[model samples]
Target: MTTTILAIFALVYLGMILGGLPFLQLDRTGVALLGAIALISLDAVSLQDAVAAVHLPTVILLFSFMVVSAQMRLGGFYSWATRGMANLPVSPPWLLGLLILMSGALSAVFSNDIVCLAVAPILAEACIRRQLNPVPFLLGLACAANIGSAATLIGNPQNILIGQTLQLSFAGYLQQAMLPVLLGLAACWAIICWQSRGNWQSSAPLPATPQLRSSDEQALDRWQSLKGLAVAAALLGLFLFSPLPHEQLALTGAGLLLMSRKLHSARMLGLVDWEVLVLFAGLFVVNHALQGTGLPATAVAWLAAQGVQLSEPWTLFGATFVLSNIISNVPAVMLLLPVASHELAGSMLALVSTMAGNLLIVGSIANILVVDAAARHGIQIDWRRHARVGIPVTLATLLICAAIFALRL
Candidate 1:
């Protein structure tokens, strides 16, 4: 049974690393789900135990926020915000600064992926209209979203997982992360500005920008937007002052939004990223089963003996940086959560893992969304272009995070 569980676990993570097994229809979410089903089918874990292995708080928190982000998306808040940013009467560098600030701040509150999805195409069109190069601005969007999501525990999925699993304080984590995230965002603006020094004006003749469908573009619904903002603001207050479980409060907020007469529950629920929720569920079970097998503990012991310890913030940062890029942030956090013992471990994991997503094009969903979005308007941001900004920005932000963590220590 141990050997069988181990093989299943290995295969599942292999899928994570390669982004799915060759010639298989399964993606990461599918691979994770299948692994859990296999564990149950083979009696490696009982139905009850498999269910227990799942973390309800993390799952619920993620689902609830997805609904909130859906509400914002349907309200057309993102398009309104991004369009407003692009049309700002400012120079190109100032415009880059504003984009980073807006995207980062919005991402810190809502879903980073949703922010990218709604803003990317519209941003491309605006840039093309101005005859300004969109590549730097797009890169700014991806990098800022990743950095900003690290600002608060509720900002991103992995952060939510770490916060719930470690029982970290939302306000405390925010206090510690605020300075680093701010510095990271500044670094993002600087790098993009420096890199695009002479290229702010695209030399390529503006291609006719493709028109987005009416269904694709959402006009701002004032009432719905105000409603979503009220819920989000209220939740933030509750998260800070109330000692209640974050999932419970967020769930309540989601409920209130769903009861609105203007938006159908079906529409609100439809925007939820169910696949990611399933991915979290599947990983929870798989990781719990693996922990039961004692291999992870043994490996931690072995690494400790070799002068490498994950309990140390720096070591944990290094491990997270590599694993996040190799697989993905959520799964990587699941794997490393076992060795995370320091009080600052949760903060370290959340900040490092999130920032590392800016390193590669495949690192974050936000990056992929932005790149795909640019392609629609004849703006090709290939691996080389992404790497040029991604590598430097990632390194700079990680350095800022390390410095901050050191001061905290």
Candidate 2:
């Protein structure tokens, strides 16, 4: 049973690295689900044990926030914000700064992926109208979204997992992460600015009138938007001051949002990404079964005996970077979570693992989504252009974060 579980574990994580077995026609989520089924069929883990391994709080918290972001998206808040930002007549440098700040701020509150999705189309259109280069702004949206999501526990799936697994304080994690996030956003802007200094002036003429769509031009529900904003603000305040569990507070807020008459309960529920929740639950069980086989701890001990330690922050940071780039961030976090401690090591691991996604277009799902959206609109963001900003920005921000961790922790 032990050997079988270990074999399943190795194959599952290998699937994670390769994104699936070669020519297997499966994704990370499919691989995780299969691994869990294998463990159950082999009796390596009972059904009850699999249920116990899945973390409900993390899953619920993630689901609740997705609802919140969906409400904002439906309300046209993102479009409103991006349109306002692009309408400004500032120079290219200031416009880049605006894009960075806006992307980071919105992503800190909402899912970075959604933020990019909502804003990218309008940003592309705005650039075309202004005759400005859309490539820099598009890359800014992706990098800023990735960097900004690091600011809070609720910002991304991996952060939520890290927070719940380690029982990290919401406010405390924010305090520890805000500096790096802010610095990282600035660094992103600096790199893009330097790269596009000569190309600042667009040769294309601004359109006679901005060609916004009817759907895009529809006014946001001021009341619904205000109410959702209020609920989100209250949740953040509770995170800072109240002793209530964050998951409970967030769930309550989601419940309140569902009770609204203007938006159907089913509609809001439909917006939840059920597949992602399933993926988390399935991976949790699979990883738990593998941990039960004693291989992970034994490996850690063996490495320690050789004067290497995975528990060290820097070591974990490096491991996480490589794992994240290979398997994607969420699965990488799942694999690393058992060995993580909530101190500087875990915090650094979470931040570095996420920031590493900015290194390549495929390094993060958000980047891929943005690229797909751009291509659909006849805007191609090739690898060379993306790397011009992604590589330097990722390296600079990761270094800044590493430095901050060394000095502060």
Candidate 1 accuracy as lDDT? 0.92
lDDT tens digits, residue span 1-409, model 1: 8999999999999999988888999999999999999999999998999999999999999999999998998998888888888998899999999999999999999978888888898999999888898889999999999999999988889999999999998899989899999999999999999999999998878778779755456999989999999999999999988999999999999999999888999988988989999999999989988999999889999999999987888889999999999999999999999889988899899999999999999999899999998888888999999999999999999999888888879
> Cα deviation in Å at residue 140, candidate 1?
0.6
Superposed model 1: Cα runs more than 4 Å off:
none
* lDDT for each residue of candidate 2 in 1-409, tens digit (9 for 90 to 100): 8889888888888887777788788887788888999899888999999999999999989998988887787777888888889999898889999999999988888878878877887887887777787778889999999999999988888998998889888888888999999999999999999998888654444334345565344367878788778888988899889998889999999998888878898777876778788889888998899788788899899999998788877788888998888888998888788778637866786699779999999888789877876775566788888888899999999999989988976
Worst 10 residues of 1 by lDDT: 208-217
What's each prediction's TM-score? 0.98, 0.94
Model 2 RMSD in angstroms: 2.4
Worst 10 residues of 2 by lDDT: 201-210
